[model samples]
Target: MIRITDNEFDKLASYIQANYGIFLKKEKQALVTGRLQAELVQNGFKNFSEYFEYILADTSGSAVTAMINKITTNHTFFMRESEHFDFFQSEVLPFLHSTVRNNDLRIWSAGCSSGEEPYTLAMILDEYFGNEKGTWDTKVLATDISTKVLDTAKSGIYSNDKVGTMPTHFRAKYFRRMDEKSSVIHDKIRNEVIFGKFNLMEERFPFKKKFHVIFCRNVMIYFDEKTKTELVNKFYDFLEPGGYLFIGHSESLNRETTRFSYVKPALYRKK
Candidate 1:
């Protein structure tokens, strides 16, 4: 494997942090080297610095996309964090059903990787609304920074092991066995999710309407405190009053500094 020099690593790390809000520490050098080694060889680069320079000059920006797909960790599986979904089904959906004035419901799965999270949400919404689903708008906007993952997410296919953790009923109802080892989301459920490529580092949000619920779980673990704080605050603004934000269990927000009300671990509500 081609070794990444300290200078080259620093430059690449800084670029990723600045553009993606991901904090790549010194300890991650081995990870960077491993993930990028193939790309370096495939692109005919003799050294990390040369590859870095090529990335900076690639006007098509596909190089950046490819780099990010390797750099960003996208290891999510169906219902990986089950508690959030439980809370959503038991508490959030009930509240929305009772209080939301119009039939329009908006939920966002930011950094939705490989389709699992958003697909899970879509299934929950389908169950919650049941026959009333036709009366309400219940689609979710799923976005991620990696085009590669977005493509996978759009296809909504998962290996059996990946889908194994899903609840029995959810698996039975929403997914169709594509083969011996893979399952694909049902068309009706799949249609409820719209996937897009989005970078969290963008200063301004472009949404015309605020979300009723935002599932940004596990996505911010890669971000530094400053980046996470800024991004959380942006989430606050984009959420409807009383809207809920579900983050990863490992993450936290300082209640003293933010407008969101702490509902539980990894869960908050815009007050």
Candidate 2:
């Protein structure tokens, strides 16, 4: 078993928090060991402290991104919570379609790891609006701190196993089989999504345009209460009024922030 001393854990946790806003707990020491052992060995580091030193020396190191990707649990799928999509279709889209002057609909999949979440959103939009022909100006911006996952997401290819949650009709309609084991997202759907590397801990977003829907699910669970509040507020600022914020089913903004009002169990609207 890989060993993680208290000092090593603290160093790593601090580094991750500073760089990615992910607060690794003491219990996660073992998890860190399990996930980064091979990386340490590959990088010729004898122990966790040495790896920590390497990270401190170069915060932009790929090791840090790899570590973040390993530690951050990305348990998401196409329409993981069906109700959110139902609400999006039944309520959010119609309202936006009517009130918004342009044909453009902006969506931000904030922690969209390996592309499933945003691609799933793209498929839904195409299916619901019949805009797959590229006649409409719709786009989904998918961002993640991990360059590894962002690269995978940009590739827009997934093993059949990773796409198990996708509906049969959607799979047939929006994806083409790339090979025996993987499928490629159709160009119309793939082009609708733009993937980027983003650290949510950043003080400000550089974009002039705000988003209509922000899907930041399963990400805030890694942040502390203060960080959660700050991030939620940032999300609120990044959204247009009445825009929707979809978080993980297990997460809530009850005590996090007042910038958004809870619309459903895990859905919130900017106020």
Candidate 3:
């Protein structure tokens, strides 16, 4: 593996933070080195500096996508933070069903890694609406920076271990067996999620319509307080009044600094 010098590391770290809002602390230098070293050597780049320069010049965008895919951590599984789903079903769904006038429900999995989180949302929406699902437009917009994971998500196939975390009935109802070791999401569930590539650090969010519920769980953990605060504020702007935001259980926002009302642990409301 090729070594990344301190100069290269700083340059790469700053680029990631500036463009993606992921703050790589000094301690993460080794992690940066390890994740990227093999790729750098294999691609015939002697150092991180040369690779980044090529990434900047590549207009087709594949190179940038590759670097983000390897650098960003995408570890997540089905039904992660189950209580949030529980609340979404029992409390949130009922409210949206009653309140939303046009039968269009907007749900966004902002950092939907490998389709697990958005798939879970689609499944929950599927069960809740049932026959009524046909009348309402309940597509969940799932976006991530990594095109590699988005490709995996679009495929809607998962290894047995990833699907194993869900309940048996969930397994039987929403997924079909692909093989001995994998499962493919059923068409009903898969069609409900629209995956796209998005970067949170973009100067402006491009959505014209606001969402009723946004699930950006576990993603803000990679960002620092300033970045986190800025992104949270942007989330606030794009949500309709009375909409809910659910974040990772491990992450929190300062009530004193944020516009969102504290609803529960890792859950906030736009009042």
Candidate 4:
């Protein structure tokens, strides 16, 4: 195991937290060092300290963004926790259709890595509404901190392995096989989602309108308690009243500060 010194870890953590909202914990030193080793070597730094100095000196450079992307985990897949999709289609959509005057329903796939989650949501929405495309405006806003992942997401191409977990019929309906081992999201469904590069640490979300549902699954595990509390509160503020927030199955908000009431385990609704 490559050991990261305390000073080295602190420097990297501060840099990451300042640039991105991600908080590196003491236990993650080894993981950070391992993941960023190549970058360090590529930049011609002998150790973490030298690399830290270089990044600190050039705080506004792409190096900071690249470092955050490398260190943050982006592991995600289609239909991850199928229950959430079921809830969205059966429970959330109907509620929105009846309550909101406009047929438009906006959902935010926060920390949407490599496009799987947002695409999955798009497919579900397409199936739910059938051919009534003109009657309703349904779209997904997918954002992530990693430009690398967002670039791949914009291409709408994925290897067979990435789609292995999706149902065969749905895959056939929404995706076209690009080649022997790859597939691309069909244009109809692909056009319904907008992908952008966003850092969650920003105090203000750029959108003027509030989202009806926000899926921020599996991204909070990297943050500490203070960061998690602040993020949960921010999500609450960004969501419309009675809107839903879906977090990772393993993550929970500090109940006192968050106005969201628990609807399901790991799921909350803005009060």
Candidate 5:
């Protein structure tokens, strides 16, 4: 593997942070180099610095997209964080039931890697609505920066180990056996999620309608304080006044920086 020099590491890390707000700390040098090696070699680059310049010169932005896809971590699975789903069902949905007009619920799973979180949400929505599902528009807008994971999310196929973490009833209800080792999400649940490629660092969010709930869990951990603050405020603006925002249990919002009212650890509400 080609070794990444400090200068090369700084350049790539700075570019990724500036463009995507994903803070690659100094300690991640080996990780960055290792993950990017195959891409660098496949593109005919012998060194990190050369590949860095080529990425910058590629004006179409596809190179950077591919770079991020290679470098970003997208390790997530079904029901990875069960408590948030429980809260979404018990507290958030009831509020929406009383307040939402047209029986329409717009939820976004930002950084929805490989579909588990949004798929889980979709299943909960399916179960919540039951026979009345057809009468409501409850589609989930699931987005991730990586096209690789978005493709996986769209396909809705997973190893048995990943999807098996959910309840037995849920497993039986929403998934079909693909083989001895994997399963595919049922089309009924699969169609409820709309996956797209999104960059959270965009200067402006492009959505005509605001969301009732936004699940941006575990994503902001990569961001610096300023970037996380800006993104949280953007999420606040895009969420309805009373909507909820769920972050990873390990992540938190500073009371001094955000308008979101802290409801619990890693959970907040716009007021």
Candidate 6:
């Protein structure tokens, strides 16, 4: 493995924090080394310094994209944190359906990893709206920083075990068996989610419409206290009044610092 120097580590860590809002501490150096060792070896780079320059000088942005992909972990499965989905189906959906005059149910699956969360939400939306689904704009916007994961998400394919934990009825209705080992999400659910590469650190979000719900679960754990506060505020701004935010259960907001009202564990409201 190509060893990283203290100075080289500092430079790379600063760059990641500034550009991606991902805070890497000194203790995580081993993690950085482990994740990025293959990239350096594959490219014939002798050290982190060379790799850093390679990323900085690449104007097409693929180099840095690849760097982030290696350093970030994207572990997720369908119906993760099941209670949030239950709340969405039982309370949020019914409220939005009745109150949203435009019949446009805007939902976002921010930091959606490998497509499971957004696809799961799409299935729920399909089941909830049923016959009236055609009349409503129920599209879900799913975004992630890694292009590799975005590509996987866009393909809408998954191993059978990945979708296996889901309830039997959902597994039967939403997935089409391609082989014994894998299944593909039916186009009905796949089409409802629009996948894109997005970096949450961007100063401004590009959307014109505020969302009715934002599911940014487990993504903020990488950020520091300041970064998390800023990102949470950004979420608050992009959501409509009475909108709901679902975060990782392990994460909590400082009630003193945040504008969002506490609703339950890992859930908040924009009112």
Among the numbered candidates, top lDDT falls to 6
Q: lDDT of candidate 1 vs native?
A: 0.92
lDDT of 4 by residue, 65-131 (tens): 7776788778888899899888988999879878865887889999999999999999988888888
Instruction: Report, for every candidate in turn, its global Cα lDDT versus the true structure.
Output: 0.92, 0.83, 0.92, 0.86, 0.93, 0.94
**Pairs that collide, model 3:** none
How well is each residue in 115-168 modelled by candidate 2, as lDDT tens digits? 888888888788778743365567889999877788888888888876766878
- Give one digit per residue, the lDDT tens place, for model 5 in 74-119: 9887887788999999889888978998988999999999999999
Best by TM-score: 6
Clashes of each: 0, 0, 0, 0, 0, 0
Instruction: Give the lDDT of residue 162 in candidate 2.
Output: 69
As a TM-score, model 4 comes out at 0.94
TM-score versus the correct structure, for each prediction: 0.98, 0.92, 0.97, 0.94, 0.98, 0.98
lDDT score, candidate 4, position 223: 78
Candidate 1 shows a clash count of: 0
Candidate 5 has its poorest 10 consecutive residues by lDDT at 74-83
Candidate 5 regions with alpha-carbon error over 4 angstroms: none
> What would the TM-score be for candidate 5 when compared with the true structure?
0.98
Worst lDDT window (10 residues) for model 1? 75-84
| True lDDT of residue 238, candidate 4 | 88
Quote the lDDT for 270 in model 3: 98
> Candidate 1: where is the Cα deviation over 4 Å?
none
